[model samples]
Structures are given as structure tokens and as C-alpha cells.
Target: MNKAPLITKMLPRKNSLRNGGELDTKQLLAALMAFRRGDFSARLPEDWTGVAGKIADTFNDVIRTNQRMTQELGRIVRVVGKEGRITQRAALSDVSESWGDAIGCINVLIEDLLRPTSEMARVIGAVAKGNLSETMASEIEGQPLKGEFLRTAKTVN
Candidate 1:
């Protein structure tokens, strides 16, 4: 029996399959869902890699801003002003509120940065855990929790 060609019989591919540029939301969402299920390289748009770094940088900035605000609030709390520190306390509270807002901003930025990569990394890392060699595991276990990885040791002698 002469059947229609196999290619003709097959269903049409999605838009991403036909197009050759940035993946749309559906594709990204599918990839994210796939990432949740198992390991898969979450392909990013060429511009995405750059954008991720920027988001991380912004997150860092927010953290720094929070720290600075906290320190400034502490200083304000210590000040001996003629208004009996009420004004200073109020100002410090405002700064603390601002710090809270900054933290929220950082949360949003982190979510943006993590959109797909976090899931991808989680899936990949989980897969890696299952496939780790004893030697690699030993190396990781043995590696000093110091040097570049330890923030507390920033001023190591």
C-alpha cells in the first residue's frame, strides 16, 4: 500500500521549530517545566546571558544598599539631638522601611534572574548528584571552605 510520505503525515512543528531566533514564552516555559522534571540545558537567548549578570549585579546593589541603610539607622539611633531623639528615631524608621523596600526590590530582581536558570541549574545539579564520582565527591568534601568562597575570610592574614 502506498502511504503518504512520513514527513507529510507528521504533525506540524511549533513556531520555535520553524523560526530560528529567540524562543518565545511558551518555549521558555516548556523548557522550564522540562527543567523541573529532569536535567536539560536551558538554552538562553544570546542577550539573556548578559541580562542575567545585570540582574545579579542589581541584586548585589540592593543588598549593599540595605546594609548601608542599616548602618545609617544604627548611627541615627545613637545620635543625641535636641528633639530628644524622636526625630532621629522617626528618620531611622523611615530608613529601615526603605531598606525593607530595597530588599523587596532585590527579591524581584533575583526572581527575574532565576526565571529559568534556577530550574535548569536545579535539575542539572540534581542529575549531577546522582552521577558524581567518588573522587569528585571527595575533592568537594576536602576542598577548604575558605579562600575565594568564604566571605568571612575576606581579610585573611
Candidate 2:
């Protein structure tokens, strides 16, 4: 019942070129989704398990930082300016910038999380090259964030 070899063998018969030569982005996205949601715990690949754990840790840290930013922005919002007027514009701008910084931080974390995974890039590149069919594209497009990244990539191309 060594499923790894069994699965590997079956994939080639399924789509030799697409599976072996260039992985479908849909498959990769599915894998990533499962990994993130802890759905693939039983059959987690060794390499991916290590990377995913680190990514999860970083994700938690980023979320905590975002919470702190929100609290600080809330305090700023409560401040009043001269003539007893609430500094609405300044407060709004500060809140916006704080949220933007949180977004930037999350984006940086994403880059770090993905930078070590050449496999992800390769799969996405395959999708970019039109190797995946419409059904596969749809599945990947349904994945959160994956769709937006793919759309942005398409726009750039």
C-alpha cells in the first residue's frame, strides 16, 4: 500500500506530458489549498510539509501584526484636532495607510512563502503556456488568490 509510487505511476498513464513534463496549475492549486487547510495531512509530501509549516508560522505572525495595526489605527481614530473637531481626514488617512501596510506585509510574507518553491512557478508557467485545458483552468480559477494571481499574470503577458 505504498501509495506514492502507485500515484506516480498512475499520473503518467493519465497525462504523460502534462503531468510529468509540466504540472497543471489546477493540480498545484488544489495541492496548495489542501496543504493550507490541513486537508492533506495524511498524505503530505515531505518537502511540502516542511515548507507549509513555515508558511503557516509566517502567516500567523502576519495576522498578529495586522491586529496590532488595527488597534493602533482605532486609537488614532478617537483623537480630536483643534477647535474640538475630530481629525477625520488625518485619521482616515492614517487608518488607510495602516491597512495598506498590513497588506504590504502580507504580500511580502506571500513572496517569502513562495520563493522557495520552484515547483509552484513551474506549474503556473505551464498554465500560462496554455498547456492546461478549460476545465483545469476553471478549477484553478476557483481557488482563492490563485485566480487573481493568474489573471494578473495573464494581463502582464
Candidate 3:
């Protein structure tokens, strides 16, 4: 009977439904909303084959790349700033465009910060060894010392 077809349709398909991860409009909206709220965990279902699936795959790739970079930068910040490890550098595998520029800037900042300390130590150590001819350079990394550092450098010189 035709009624039988309707009843059969009411029965769940054999492993066809995607549970809560279907790539419907509702799922897409939910994923977008989650991403807007800074949650990158909600990803579209890429298993569905079609243009929608390809788009989902691309979107998921972007999210994964962003998450990876954010976590890596945060780790570097924690290690260098909180842990006082100025030697720590962001190890970016996919350094492209501004991503590479940002990582390079951070590494350069760390180097710039460490340079003065290193120069001061070297000059002071030389002075301690009775080599007064060795004086703290007027500038480090092309940036002249300021405030207390400048005063100390002048006194040491």
C-alpha cells in the first residue's frame, strides 16, 4: 500500500542521517554564530558531497589555521613575557603574508628587548675586568637608550 511507503519513510534511514552535524541552513547559521562569538570549535559538516561540502572544507581549514596561529602566539607570549624567557620565538610552520610578518615582528621585538641587556652586561663585565675602554654603546640595535638606561650608560662610559 502507498501508506506503507509513508510509514517506511518515517523509519530512520540506515546510517544516512548525520545526527546533529548535518550541513543544513540551521547548522551553517549556528556555525557562523559560534565563530562570530570567537568559538572556532563549531565546524560545518564536510562529509556531505557537493559545493556545500567544498565550502565547508575551506571554512574549516581557515578556522583550523586561525586556531593554530592563535594558540601558537599565545604560547609564545606566555613563554616570553610571563616566563621571562626572551629567547623564546614563535615557530610558525606556515609563515605567509601577514602571518609571517607578525611572527617576525614578535621575534624581532624579543631580540630588541634582549639586545640592550646583553650589551649592558658585556660592557659592565668588561669594565669589571678593569677594561674602562669598553663602554656601553650609545645605542643598541639603532635605538638609543632612554631614561634610566641612558643615565647608566653615560655613568658607565
- Give the candidate number with the greatest lDDT: 3
Model 3 C-alpha lDDT per residue in residues 1-157, reported as the tens digit of each score: 3699888776435423344333466677888898888798979886855555766888887788778888988998799889988778987786599888888988887887778778888988998898989988878868888887788778878
Overall local distance difference test of candidate 1: 0.42
List of clashing residue pairs for candidate 1: none
Best by TM-score: 3
Candidate 2 residue-wise lDDT, 1-157, digit = tens: 6789877775534323431243343555665576466443312222333434444445444444445555544553454223322322222233456576665664454443343233345656776888663221212324433554556445433
lDDT of 2: 0.44
Off by over 4 Å in 3: 1-23, 123-134, 146-157
lDDT of each: 0.42, 0.44, 0.78
Model 3 sits at a Cα RMSD from the real structure of 11.2
After superposing candidate 2, which stretches have Cα over 4 Å from the reference?
1-49, 81-157
TM-score of each: 0.24, 0.24, 0.65
Q: RMSD of each candidate?
A: 23.4, 24.4, 11.2
